[model samples]
Target: MKPPTDTDTLTAPADATTVENPAVGIDQTAGNFSYKVDYAFDAGTGLSEDTVRYISSVKKEAPWILEFRLAALKKFFSMPLPTHWATKDLEAIDFQKIRYYLSQGQKPKRTWDEVPDDIKKTFERLGIPEQERKFLAGVEAQFDSEAAYSNIKDIVAKQGVIFVNSTEGLREHPEIFKKFFGKVIPTGDNKFSALNSAVFSGGSFIYVPKGVKVAQPLQAYFRINAENFGQFERTLIICDEGAEVTYMEGCTAPKFSTSTLHSAVVELVALKGAKIQYITVQNWANNVFNLVTKRGIAHEDAEIKWIDCNIGSRLTMKYPGVVLKGERARGEVISIALANDGQHQDTGAKMIHAANHTTSNIVAKSISVGQGRSTYRGVVHIPKHLKGCKNNTECDALLINTNSRTDTYPAITVRGDKNSTQHEASVSKVSEDMIFYMQQRGLTEGQAMSLAVNGFINDLARQFPMEYSVELKRLIDLEMEGSVG
Candidate 1:
């Protein structure tokens, strides 16, 4: 395990963490974990008003929702691919070739033991049930297009916390769900947002009551187990005045030659003096495309924070944002992205300082391996009318080899003299010298590489929960295992 010398360059190598060449029955990760579900409800293939109607009718949604879906369908058709500023590869998406929805047409079981055997086995393999029992106050498990299991701890539920799937929430708690359903992220926010609105299904809707603090995090897991399928889940979370809550989501999909699409829209609202933290860790097979839109609004003295990690997708474009709508509101985004061979990770954050004394921060780090590419596209805005507004942005990229690429595009507009902002960006390759030095100290090249990569993002990783931070490091190590070639 000799380390490369100055004259010997280490180009990017294919990632070994994901499964090599996919066969018809193999998943890219989780030890070939996948389910052969027999969905009873299918919206057929493609995107059309009919397809939208089918999905709405199957859900037996209210007339208003059907109207919303129809309107969003029109918008999805009217909007062109956002290739002008985004990657042109978006054109590869063929709405006609993708299935809009697929479901077992069953209600989510409240208990894990009550879930279907096949679905339960899938979650058991993913360790979702165990995680929920150990550390989570609530958990929602969605398989493909519908929730297979959803439950909240009794103690937490008794505190007036409402945690349920979006459909259930809308049907059972309209007064609260309707008030903030599409407020933070409107249907027209983007093409994908429109698409999600047109046929969204199986996502979490959470409401934290005033002055109540959730001691444990609420969790959601989204699994894609079918081929040539599209999953669009819409999640909405609201925290009343002086309330605090944390929600974490994990996503994964099997390896499919035909490709899978995951387009989701998440919206959050934090009332006065409330705090909300949203966390996501997505690891899709290289055959899947992950496109998402997430945004939040922070009211007076409220705080919003987004902790995002992206890995293992053919392409990913996500930008979590926050609007500081009231004075003394604060926003923050901490992001980590790793792109391996044949993968592209495009991620960043957005902050809108709408009131005086609003503050925001963004920290993003990306790793590119093999022929993988990574990009950081961000936006920070402070209006001229706002006073005492401040923003800070930092983006750092790590290139594993000569063939990997990284880019940073930051848009910052601070109009008032009273506002202050700082922006910093950097790109660097893994240092062979450091590897050699560590090798001299008896560390193998792979270990050395993993150590360096971990150190690069250690501070951000530490911000995650203890369990998640460990998992994140383990994934980083898996990515490095194949880089030494």
Candidate 2:
């Protein structure tokens, strides 16, 4: 595989302003890129009891954590790769050849200058620090298997909001960490979940105090700088009663001849009257298999929302879910996926209405180019005892080439007489007439295709924060560069 070229480098002005309109012009040069870095420690390759013990010892984790990891490892080995469905290419993953963990010995730096030069340059190119200074209330940066830099604004910290890496949070606030860790999504939920639980490393841990609202979003960036490696980060977010917070995460990896793995587990808790929003923009290299499990619990009158955008990966299977465990709880999932040549993005959402008067919504958009494929698998359930429950799901797919493919599988179960459920799906190809019309207006075919794709997800993109929305548009344009003849 070739290293990233200059054209792939994502460059932005230090003071770049966010664009509000999707149709408006964006910096076409802004794109995703990757580079390699040296590591202080590498767990060689393969998985075993010794590997697990080595990881635990390196982190100096508690005895209980070590026990939990060993148990989860046993579970992972006992289970089989998903053979029922979506198993055609999953068998290709060579577990024995993949490195489980790799990291530098440096602790997370509070100041930019303290970060290692190579890692700092990588984050600088990604604009993590600049975004932190401009709008983010806090930022955590992970390179390979550990956090490299973490800092929260002083004012936000003074407000009693705790934003730190998972390791620190567990070491410093065991009371709060132990209460919710693995509570939302258990270790044995699935094969990938078990794998993550066994080898999880650096991820964000946030706690919003009661009644405090974080006006600005907190951000985290994960970069896989090594080849043929796996990144397993565990994230947990807890919101106390009457508090509100929004968190966003981004991920990327370098192109490699061999496959890389990214399996993460994210759990969220929304207490009574609290609100939590989680957003993710995953732009991995085509040689990466991105499998993740994310779920949240919403208490009475609380809300949980997941805004997900998937752009590149060899194969990605993720479905963020929410359990409405209290009356009047609400859950929403807004997603957009783009699959170019040789890529497969299978993504969706799940909503379980366990309480009366609960509501849920799912809106998904997908685009397939060349021989790429996109699939949407969703589930919404309202039991017989639940009353006044409502669910609405919509899935839309756009194919930009003759070889592009898409599939939709939505299973909705509503047993209660008073509950209501609605599902809508559409599959369409880019119209040549629209391309011709745009070309007549002095735009290239590629630009026309990009514009049409952008228009399809314009409404949903508006739901994202301004900065991310702008970056999403630029990424779309970049993907559409060679889509059309």
Candidate 3:
């Protein structure tokens, strides 16, 4: 496809700020735009028990939830940064300097018409409304600390599928939400998870009933609008026996002079004979510290898969994981990451085989451009007791400059002779000769480079939904031009 033209831009309403370039991002990367608005509620700066209590009180949360948040705040304070294993850049995150919550204090509207104009314009510029109208079964748009709008298609809602933000799920569907919440990835799972549990706000909560299959995908969009702020959203999805669903999320934050934090926790549970597919595509500004933890559990004869794509951030450390807990369960992860100058994409996957005849697969590709760095760290394990378990892993990297760097850390352990596993890794730079040939054939250097990069990850990109895959390719093409610039 040729490069995106001016017509492809996403424009805001007359009153909201407009980004001339559709590629100005948060559409894909920079999320670089802003507008004026007044927040009715604020948790103020810094993290403490008082901050947590204020958040709980503002939400009118249950006493048990307040208790949980206070406990998590203690856990967060006691834990230290994982600089020993992770990058030292994480040490720069000043917990006390960040504002935990800022919102307009509006309940999520079921109709776009009821949404405040400013918030609605933000989502409009991001194409949230248009996309939902075209294909999604449900949609949620979150700005800073709260969801501004959330709606589900009538047909899908009639199927007994519950799609709402986390607050509603906890208060309205506690009988189901309480059991699975924090059970997959608890507060102590990591420091960031604890932080999220303490101040968590807007995120998608979906429950698919037994034997029900959602026909269209459900999508959520996350935006961070303020400076020196943190957005902590919690998402949980549960698929009952014989049910199936696909959920996707997109995130972006505008450029900030100071550091911004986007820490989130996601959990998924697939019951017997159920299937769940999760997809995330994030493009953040260089000021964002994108640290998130996502994991899923697959029960007997169930399947879980994650399709993750990362494009921009100052430093990103995320590893999506899956635990195969019953006989014949399956899990898979497909990932693509691009790191530009002054950015690091540290990402991978983890798979644990716990029962007989389980299987897992992982495929990851990275592009390092102009001194950018990308690392792939993965773990796959099958204990000696598990028989006939199998796993396959592949990591590939493409460098666009001599200074670009990539690393691979694969920890694969299979104890039983009955288990089988395979791993493959490759690293290479962009071929100057191919770029010259494409230029000779009437392609610009940027176009040629984008073509080469797209070729390297096209097969993996196709794993996304059809329209989204096309958009993914466009995203790559646009970012390749920026890398060259």
Candidate 4:
């Protein structure tokens, strides 16, 4: 098939006021868009020991990895669905009906032209290549369960930084990979995490050498092309002592009549005096169920931060977390979630203080439109022995309509003396009077609403990279277009 042109992939909604300039390339104007692709190999529907073995065999994984997969598979089957969680829709996922893996069965290519046409076109629409050329130091593009393209700038690679798909990282850097693999986030941490461990496919593995500071960000983009499929990507990032690195990831899937599943496990490790920033922007189709487990460990004087934005999905339950394992370590979480129509976004942060003189912060914002529901669930723990520990958590929700719903459940356990902690939460609605005030200035109701919502998350949005911030604002504007009557 001929590769699709830019015009073919990007379809602007009729009501869209802004046409995304290709220069900035992350197009927020494209609405519920998708293309067809043929898979070279597909592990037929259902999950079992056979399916796990098939996936491992296809990847030519090492024996140890295979053993891990089998053990995790057993755990997945034994574990029950999280019925007590905020998202009751967990009962709707039919694990037996979803394809465990789908891939083109090709090694990652360094050049865009060498990438499969259909897959290339998909990333082209998302502007992955262009973004790599402009700002990113390294890029990995995952298409339906595997990385189709992975490359790093020669200059950065020469600096002793390793950025590759998890498959290659396991094969090439077993020593480093094994030391921290599943150490931060164990396979049995949760059911979804176990599922990801059992059938994990393409996700990025990054290692920054000691004392090296990567000035530019490394990125991975995941796209799901098959229907009724389960995408399980495992990502691990390690920052050595005195090292600093920033990594970003984005995901999207086609609109399918039947539900699709995305379950991923991400683990980050920051050694003594190191720093790591992990960012994620997920815009899955409304029929997709996104359940993920992400956590990091910060050693002595180290830092770890999670910047997350969730926009589109039938249901999303993710809590990016951090463990301060060494004295003076720091962690922060900045999150923004928007639930529209029939969607539900359940996301928050977890901070576990295991040492003295540690600090943690969490700032979360959510917007609910139509009948959508947005929830914030978080946990902060400080043991009795820890001193000089501090925590601050703030959660705010914005309701667009009367039917819209919002909930906040924060669990804070503090047993230490001389440790300071603060928690704040507020829920508000867009008042007619505010809209009228903006309308008096000749702005339409939709524009006013968009402006209001943008202002609500402006602080958190500013925390995003410049390019992403622009696209995020555009997406918010698009979501606000028809929000009000």
Stretches of candidate 4 exceeding 4 Å from the true structure: 1-24, 27-31
Instruction: Give the higher-lDDT candidate: 1 or 3.
Output: 3
What's each prediction's clash count? 0, 0, 2, 0
Better of 2 and 3 by TM-score: 3
Lowest summed lDDT window (length 10), candidate 1: 1-10
lDDT of 2 by residue, 411-436 (tens): 89999699999999999888778889
TM-score of 3: 0.95
Off by over 4 Å in 2: 1-36
Ranking by TM-score: 3, 4, 1, 2
Give the 10-residue window scoring lowest on summed lDDT in candidate 4: 1-10
What Cα-based lDDT does every candidate model obtain? 0.87, 0.87, 0.88, 0.87
Give all candidate RMSDs, comma-separated.
9.9, 6.4, 6.2, 5.2
Candidate 4, residue 431: how far the Cα is off, in Å: 0.9
Candidate 4 overall lDDT versus native: 0.87
Q: What are the per-residue Cα lDDT tens digits for candidate 1 across 266-322?
A: 999999999999999887888788999999999999999999999788999999999
Cα-based lDDT at residue 335, candidate 4: 93
